[model samples]
Target: MEPLGAGDPIRLGPYRILGVLGAGGMGKVYFGRDNTGRTAAVKVLLPELAHDPHLAQRFLREAHTAQAVTSGGVARVLDARIDGDDSRPWIATEFLSGPTLDDAVRAYGPFGADGVRALAASLAATLSDIHAAGLVHRDLKPPNIVLTATGPRVIDFGIARPEHGMTLTTTGQVPVTPGYGAPEQVLGQRVGPAADVFSLGAVLAYAATGRRTFDGTHVAAVQYEVVHGEPRLDDVPAELRHLISPCLAKDPAHRPTPEQIAGAFAPPQGADRIWRTGPLAKDIARRGAEAARQATLVGREPGSGPSRRRLLRASLAAGAVVAAGGGAGAWWLLREEPRTPVESGLASGAKLLPRSTAQSGKAPKPLWGPLPVAAKPVDGLVPAPLSLRDVVVFAAKDGGLAAHFTRDGKEKWRLPDVTPAAGLHPLTEQLFAAAGTSGALRVHDASTAKLQWELPDADVGRFLTMDDENLYAVTRGGQLLAVDLTMQSIRWTKPLPTYAVRGAGPRAAVAGVTLVLFGDDGAVRAFSTIRGLDMWTIEGQGKSGSAIAPAVVKRKDSNGTSYTVFLGGRTLKALKFPGGNEVWKAGPPQNGTDSWGAPLVHGDTVIATNGTTLAAYDLDGRQLPLNGRAARGPLPATPLVRQGEALWAVEADGRGVSAYSTTDGARLWTWSAESRGPWGMSGAGNRVFLVNDGKLTAMPTVG
Candidate 1:
């Protein structure tokens, strides 16, 4: 590797580029070393190609295709940055030592019979692995084959064709290596694995004879020679000449498959160390050692092995939690940046006013914090208000643990300490429930903070809902479990055909005696609370349900039928309770915002916000008389329902609240407060609570 020139980027993401490996038509490959002590061949697309959407897509396709081929015979793609304007569209792969097949054969002459057989087997195996993954290596020239200590590893998947139907070249452009081009590729016809086999034959013939099978002075001549003419297997080993001849068959169907060639040239005994004592092996070792020293100087110690590196790259790319040692511990690569504490609007030790203060014509001042307690700051948006006697419960967005504080801003109780993994939540106003990491469910009394009952065999509960008598929980596995609080045990548990979609919010409802469960498969299933029998199931268009609980409404019609209203994808539909019939439906906002939070039900009005546009619908699904005025901005948070009005939130851009009349859609009052988006809202009596950023402020309902 040589030093980088003036125009090169010194650092790409976390990896430091040390030098240039080579430059191609689309990009330049660099020698990069990461902080983890991993050396990589980093390929960055040229700036012009990076800006082209089609070319960028092709570049990303190359990275994804290279990443998917997990065989040791192929170099592993370690990282990629393919999106965004500033993105240079780069991919880093394992940096291989030694020379390319073209360079090695040119410098050291043809490989003898033994070496040729080994090369054929290794290359054939690599091709077989690629084909098994439903990919065709469109470019299989000798320069793309790196001869390392391990074997002949194939590289450069920039022109690979995967089964997903993506091709290598753009309109009016052809991707092919001149001398190695197969007849189909030369004619720009439908090329597949057969075309790759033709190229492999040419590459092997060149390696064994130090000459191209079909030679020409120019690309046009080369295409002409490859399409109609053939020759030059004279120097190829006599024993393997027949195998190479079949692979070079002009009619692709007559060409031998990679599996057949690999079977024919099985690795000789002690072939694993084939490159051990050769001059080429010494060169490989020397370069490998130099690269290792370079990696060490850059702070990355060598990782366990290739398998470990592959796992790291994949998990990090998908932002997955790596649970090693058989679920002993989980490592989260996706970490929310620690939020800087927002300035509190509430003064410390502020006095709490009585509920009758509304009559005095003055909005209630903040009683206390942003409640001051020694718990980890809230990271996720707060769920529904958990009423526990005189206090309400608040928890992190994950519902992992919670804190309880009185209306007067005094600390009351907290779940078994303040750790986030506590997973404690309020089951009712009097009982708090927690699902342990071990899938054990434990119930505690709100007043005493003591264990009331325990179900040691319950599945890990993702979210909880309850009524006056029994508690309902939807486990992570999509099982609906109803535990009888009166009986102190699980009454019955039924697994839904499909649970809530992964990454979507959990939605469930306990309306009166009917327990309604919404599946991620866009189906709403209701069961009888008394008998745990399936009451009815209504399937909607396959849209995932929202994170919020369904709004349960009872119509004042002749049948007085109750219904569970759900927000799935962009559509909102009401399913008749017990009977599970579709009653009314509302599609997404057509001309306005696309973002919609959970619909809040106030009086007879069903209010939902898509971005900043607030709409209201009656129990019959008819549009209410809402004079749509834009709130401050889009409210991703669920609207806080008070008395009979919908308090629309504008938390992201503008920090404020607009209380609108749910019946007539009149703007009652608007309160502007400082906040970051993702504000949490809940209300009781005359006080509406707002938790924005790390600060909490109480807004008066009437004001």
Candidate 2:
């Protein structure tokens, strides 16, 4: 291997290697040039990881997803392929030039408020792009943030989770990480995008202050603190307090989502200050802002203050009902609403719960088990927040789309026995989603509370995306269809690629002029919407084995032609839009696989996650700096990016789901999200919708 800093040619997929752009626990990334003389970077997995199929699958997924995504914020993939025999698996991508956030911060302390705000905006926009395409970069941190000449580019997608593909992870294995992990991620609970938001909160906290939120004396202590303790914002400035507070909420449901994060961050800049008061300070401030209230903030000397202290503790415990979780960025959400709700049972039952207390921000010296949470089912939900604009569609335990919303875990709109909850299509701007499971193409319109139309007897696996005009559809039996709007007659029908055995699920994107198709084997067919002509067939070069489903990502480039792509271990392929040219390719090094995610393009960065570790590349395809990372698993769902500064994805192991950030490769947050059980969850809006073994639950992202 050559020095990453030195642009030396090395051996990689159909390309000579160059200097190393960056290095991480997974492997070293080198800046190289492809056979077509196009500049690129090849990611080489570490020798120790080279043989691990889990990491190998993750590697390929990064390539597949990054190549498909075309966004201004993301780096572009040039070429990809796997090396033979003993060679490494490598991914070649366009090179990105910029200074890492780590370098920028070191060169110039903390970024100014305006700079941070700009960075946040860019990252938020980037997140939106990938999220739309359903890709999540599971690791986001400051180091991964790059300040390019054009602007800040978020790069690195090595360990990001993807919507499809499988990773090689051993049974009974535990991942090693730091203080930034969320509670559920640590607990290995069902995870989703919010976990990354939690990581962003940690990264932001570190960026604002020179220290970590839960930097304990030991890794164990730090992990414990991350799951239970309140962070010390003693050094955070006033302007950032509220913005940062929501990210630290204790309950995953309470944390604001990336959208909320961006919205809150987009506004006014507050002065910077260290918070000396405890986590309970906000409660005390609201209850005792006036010195005469004298409950806690105005404690007197010694004996006199003892009673005041007692009152403060009592108040804190009583109000504990409202502690927010990071599923929205856990603990930080605590401040948005008081711990005590207007009519919380916990508030009423505040009589007593054995009185052991600890300092708010300081890590409590461990005695045995987890410190008790102030309340159960944290007050995470926004007070009377509006229901989701899109109605939830789910298959009844037997099979059918069921819609439900909960303000207090109450069902909103539920329609069961609708087959293929995965095949929902929102026809006519109306709410009820349409899809076919076993019977005819069923259209459930929540707006009318009835079935709009049913193309009787035609068993379909899914309904492609739709506008007011036509409904693109695919059946498990290998039939592609275009149904009319206005409940009119069928417009046309065509046979799809035979490889599309599974058929693109209902979530397929079909718009204005394009129809994106997914194949069971890592391939995608982009068709002209109106003509039904196969515009282009895009495929990632993957290893011999059962192939994963495919997806298309939207590339962002003011100048470059839009490209669509997909993922596999160590390989990424990008297809030019309109014409379907093989624009660029990136392959893995020495026995690696492809990237994960459909490959997301945002800003000047192209991201890949969940292959082995979260990784990012500049729009030029160079590897970017990063901090947080994740292991491989089932194809991950696209993440929700907020503030355009970070990307988040859910990490699932046999235990549960956890979220990760792809920007600086940091672990943002986590919650009690579980994998598919008797009753599972679905990915529709930027929230984690769960029906755990028949118990319906919802967790929103904490911005």
Encode model 2's per-residue lDDT on 290-386: one tens digit a residue.
2222212222333542342223222221111111100101111111111111111000000111112211212222111111211121111100111
Model 1 scores a TM of 0.42
Model 2 misplaced regions, further than 4 Å: 1-387, 427-432, 436-438, 453-459, 467-469, 497-499, 503-514, 535-570, 589-595, 601-605, 618-622, 631-652, 669-686, 691-695
User: TM-scores for all candidates?
Assistant: 0.42, 0.41
Counting clashing residue pairs in each candidate, in order, gives: 6, 198
* Candidate 2 all-Cα RMSD: 28.5
Candidate 1 lDDT trough over 10 residues, lowest sum: 324-333
In candidate 1, which residue ranges exceed 4 Å CA deviation? 1-365, 372-381, 396-405, 417-429, 436-439, 476-478, 496-501, 511-514, 519-545, 555-569, 592-596, 637-639, 643-658, 661-677
Q: What is the lDDT of residue 57 in candidate 2?
A: 74
Instruction: Give a tens-digit lDDT track for model 1, residues 3-83.
Output: 456778878876777555556566777667677677777777888778898877777788798777778888777888863
Best by TM-score: 1
